[model samples]
Structure formats: structure tokens, C-alpha cells
Target: MFKPFINTLALSTIAIATPLIIPIIAPAHALTEAQVLERLNGIPVFTITDDKGAPLLGSAPQKGSEKPPQVLLFFLNPDDAQATLTQIQKTNPAVGSKARIVIRSMNDAYEVIKKNQDKKDIAFQIVPAKASIESARTILTSQGKPADKLPNVPVFFAIGGKDKEQGLLTLEQNGKQLVPFFFDQKDLQSLIDRAKQQQPDVANATKIQVTSLFQVLDSMVATKDNKPNPDTERFTFVPSRNAFEYVVKNQPATTPAPATKK
Candidate 1:
């Protein structure tokens, strides 16, 4: 399982006291701790535990599955969080439930994810990262996203679905590179339009605004261990770190497909 957020408590010790000291602009109206926890109700989650009955690392079940895309909002309260989630859903029904939206930094357990299932209004679920600071850093580093101040609210990721082998092949055959963007509403629409037409996974769709963000992302990741490169498709977006993993992370675990064959 891609479980890291829950157990990142160890890394939480590393904190930014004067967050705004840097020039990085953060996300708007991200969830507060309590709100982050509450949204987890009923969404599927991936947890990491030791042999003992202690919770270690875990991730909210907010994979880049469904249709339109999946968004991960930071630092928002309940009301604000709901507003952003609702607005995104108003997209074409073809993309409505296609998106999986979530918030993080809730009470480090795995209950709210189940709550989403019981109440049953949200088409997709919101997940909480028991400890998200380190996970944020990891995601930024891995995907070549910058680190000024990761957004706390109104932050979102637009994820699309895949038909498995065919999707991976498309990326490979097309020589496509997945781009990640921190977009405002207007740019977000640009991404949505391309995603709707091509239904690319988030990375692929980001190519539309490639020059804007990739330059920074490439630099950001260059300082890390696993920066994006050729293997991005094979390791990050393919069978190992690719779209298939996104689908499997939230769904019930199944035997992993063999590395090579489709």
C-alpha cells in the first residue's frame, strides 16, 4: 500500500514556525485539524501498522481515480471545504463523481474514512492524513513540486482514470510527460477542459501548461533522490509509481499484476 501520511508523525518534528518567511503562496481556506478529520468519514483508506496494535503511517483513500479528477485540499474548515468540493462537482456529470476530493491533517486514526460510507451524500470521499507535513514534503519532492509553503486550503489535484494497460501505453507511445500545476480557478478550467477531452491522468493533463510549472518542478525534484525522468512513466506512472497504483491504492487490495505483461 502507498501508506505514508499516517506514520509521518516522526517527520512532523520538523516544522516551519514562521511559515510565510518564504515567498511561496499557500492554498486558500484549507482545512483545520478537526475539519480534516470529519471529512474522512466513509472514504476508503490505506493504513500502515506494526505487529502491535498501534497505528503507524497511513494515507487518506483519495486516489486519482474516478472521472473528472481528484483534489487534495489543504488547511480548510468544514464550511469552506464543502464549498470548494461542491463547486468542483458542478462540472459535467460525466466528471462529477469522476473526481475524488479530500482534506488532510485530521485525528490520526482511520474512522472518518468509514463515515463517508455510512452518511452517503458525497459521491467520492475525503481522506485525512494523520500527519501530513512530511508527506507534503515527500510529494513535493517526488513530483518536483516546489516547497515555499504547500497550500492549506482550496488546494486541489485534478486526477483522471485509466483503462489500465492502454492508458500506460498511450503515455509511453505519445512520449507524454505528466505535469503538476497549482492553478487558480481559470487555469483549473483549462486543465479540466483538456482532461475532459482527453481524460488524461493528472500528470498527463498538466502538459497543457507545461512550461509554467515544469521548469520549477524539475528544479525542485533535482534536489531529491527520485526526481522525475524517463522512469517517471515506467517507475512513477507505470506499474510501479504510475496510474495503476493510483487505482489500486483506494480500491481493495488485489494481487499485483506481473511487472511486464498487460
Candidate 2:
């Protein structure tokens, strides 16, 4: 089925073992470039605010300027999202403007921002967008796949401009399991350039490798040649705002505070 690709898309692993008793497998159909673009644009988008309740990024790009290509990232935990943002700031400062980095979180943005309020310069926008998150869950469920499950690590969609077409990239856990993923400004620039082109080479996109999330952390980092096994952890659903409150109240304090983004 497309489970391997789906796992790659969600940054969640899946294990497919051939059973002793063979079950009928359906033939999979490749998505046309147009259908892929439509689905990419159909991915829900919404507005978000900072800790002060001021709006940050809106549902769509600003008027008067052509919409920039976007990178939509979904994070299971706020801490992971913040950690990734910190790495970006330290490694490559210009990634924010290179592509519109939109981070989606199930936790409330106000509290998520409050947790890292000491770090003022993080470039990404984290929003507590539950409806949009649920929409993702619905689509996955209807596909006869696992219901209510999403990627654990950062799941990235490189969305093109003009037509809003997209390519998928996921940062699966590195072989050492020390870093979830890494990327730099140059990587974003490449995606942005691809989006700007009139006719993107869609076939080449599907074969793209799922690389390390630590490209920002270490330039020498190497990627695993093989895909990760299916992640066994089950997805948990909670009210976005409520998750933030719980995390804020109970988040461990023993870990030393991280340095702010430069």
C-alpha cells in the first residue's frame, strides 16, 4: 500500500511484515501532479498568535506580494518544535525568510511561547490549530490507515507557489537517535527555487530521500540509507489549549534552560 510513503510523510515509522497467510494486496495508483497539488493546497491552514495574544502568521500569505513557497511542519510536542527552532537560529539564520516556515502544534501557542519566552528570536510560528489537525486525522482514517495517528517527528511539506503544489519530506530519527532531524538555509532555498519553477519535476520528488533533521546542527552528519521501522507509539489526541496548560504546569525543570535563538 503507500504505508511506507505515508510513514515518511508523517515522520512516523511503520513495520510491514509479510504474513504466513497471504492476504490480497490492492494495486496502488500514483497520484497525478494536479491531484497532488490540489491535496497539498487543501491541507488546512489557520491563524496563530504569540504569547502576548498578538497575531503572528495568518491563514494565508500577505496581500500585495506574491505568496512565498511554504514549508508546513507538524510537531507532536512543543519542546521538540522549540528545540528545532533553536537549532535553526544557531545554524542558519536566514531559513525563516527563505521559505515561510509554518509550524503546527496541538498545544496552545500562548503557553508554548510562554515556555520559551526567554528566547525572543525564534523565527518559526507555532499555532495551536486543533481543527486543522483533526482534518489531517480524518483524511488519514478515511484512507483505511491508522486512525488518529500522525508523525512523531517533524513532518514537512515543501509547498510550491502559483499552484500551491508540494513535495513531501520527513525527518525521521537519526541512526544514533540523538537528533530527530536537521536542515539549513541552503536546503530551504533549494525547495523555494523548485517551487518557483513553472513546471516542477514531480517524478523526481517522490524518490527524494528522507534525511536527517540535524543538517542545521552538524554539517558532517550522515543520513541512514534505509528507512526506519514503523514507530509503535500510538497517537494521543487532546484539546490543544488544555495540552499547553498541562505541559506548562508539569514540564520538567531539571533540564537546563536552552540558550535563546540568536
Candidate 3:
């Protein structure tokens, strides 16, 4: 019943047609706002919205006030977003019936938060998929680190080297070597599997590292004034496969061609 409406909404606002793993080069100068936004453009997030395209909000109690802060949930997985919408539908059919999934770039959400930095009544939170979080916790525990301290929406990367000296694993695609940072642990595992097949020499040395999206973005911004190294790696962001697949499947349809003249 909601398929037509979903398609309409998708066609109207879906700017991304496929999952993109964009390579970002470290600049010689400090990262500019434009640079950060450009890097963020390649990563997509999902959110549920009404027919009017407004995100649903929830409240949490404030630190020292009777009023609570309104939080806008940005999901890393389309399934998680759908699950949330389903719960809403069960609890309140009126809003659920009109709600639809909205695909948006990470930059879109960043801009929203940036524009509202001065506002005290609202907050924006990126909700990581539960499976991803569990995988992250397991990784942390295996690394002898406390799993409870894992950051929200952790990004994973693989590195390989000998004698405690390690470097990020690079994959060759389109004849160019690129480093990939995955938003989902399962995706990283897939990459690890591929690495073992393609680069057997370094496969055994591979080690997983975890970091948050916020930390990476901040590091990029903070490196604007630093000197650029010629050997600096080009980093690629691999969004969650589930989210990426969802966007690709529902991409806007191509317009029909006009009739040819006789």
C-alpha cells in the first residue's frame, strides 16, 4: 500500500543513485568547511519522515531543566529505520501511514546540526545499527579493550604490516590503489576476506581498528593547517551495505523518451 507513496517520495528527493566510496586526499592546508562537506557527501544516512518531509523527533530530559531536548534520529541502516517506523505505525497509525523513508547524504545532516548549533532545545543523533554495534563491541573485546566504551557509529578499517609497524590495507580498483574505511563491521570482514584472496602475503598481518565518524571528520577539519605529505593515503568511506543496497534499489527512475519524428 505504501509502495507507490515511497516511490513518489523517492523519485522526488533521491539524489543518490548508487553507493559511492569516495577517496579523500589530505590537503596541505587545514581542511576547509567545503572540504569536509565534500568528504561527507559520499556517505549516506537514512531517516523516516512524514508526507511533508519533516523528520520525527523524540525528547530526552535536559540536564537542569523541566523541559527536554528534542532529538532527530539519523539511522545508519535502512532496516533499523524501517523497524523504527514499524514501531511507530503500531503505536500510532496516523503518523506511520504518512511516514516514508528519506535517503540523505551525511552532509545534509551535518549542515542541519551546524545551522542549529545555537539552539538549545534540539539535538541530532546518529543511531548506529544494532548489529554493527555488537560487532564493534566484539572487536574491541578481542583487542583487549573495554567494549562498553565503544563510540556511537564506529567506523572500521584494516591495517597490515610486521613488527608492530602497520599500514592501512589498500585495494586495487579501476587500476588505482585505495584505502577503505567501512561503516559496517560485516563489510570490513568482506574486505578482509577479499584481501586474503588478493593479497595473501599481508592477509595474516591484517588487524582491525575502530574509530567514530565524528572523530574522523574532526581530524580532517583540524588538519587544515598541517603540511601535506606526498605519501598521505587517500581514504575511502564505505557506507553500510544494507543502507547502500536500499538506496540503490529504490533510485529514481529514468524519464521516458519522446516519440521520434516520422
TM per candidate: 0.21, 0.20, 0.79
Instruction: Give one digit per residue, the lDDT tens place, for model 2 in 59-98.
Output: 2354676554232234433444455556655665664223
Candidate 2: deviation at residue 43, Å?
21
Rank by TM-score, highest first: 3, 1, 2
Q: How big is the positional error of residue 87 in model 3, measured in Å on the Cα after superposition?
A: 1.2
Give the winner by TM-score. 3
Expressed as tens digits, the lDDT of each residue in 1-262 for candidate 1 is 1122211100011111110101112222322333333332212222222223222221235447733422122221233334444555574344434433332222322333323323322222223222333444545666776754453312223333333322211221234233222223233344355444444443353322112222222333322343333322211110112212333333333312111101
Question: In what order do the candidates fall by lDDT, top score first?
Answer: 3, 2, 1
lDDT of 1: 0.28
Top candidate (lDDT)? 3
Q: Is candidate 1 or candidate 3 better by lDDT?
A: 3
Question: By how many angstroms RMSD does model 3 differ from the true structure?
Answer: 9.7
The C-alpha stretches of model 3 lying farther than 4 A from their native spots are 1-30, 62-65, 173-175, 222-225, 229-233, 253-262
> With candidate 2 superimposed using the best TM-score fit, by how many Å does residue 108's alpha carbon deviate from the native?
18
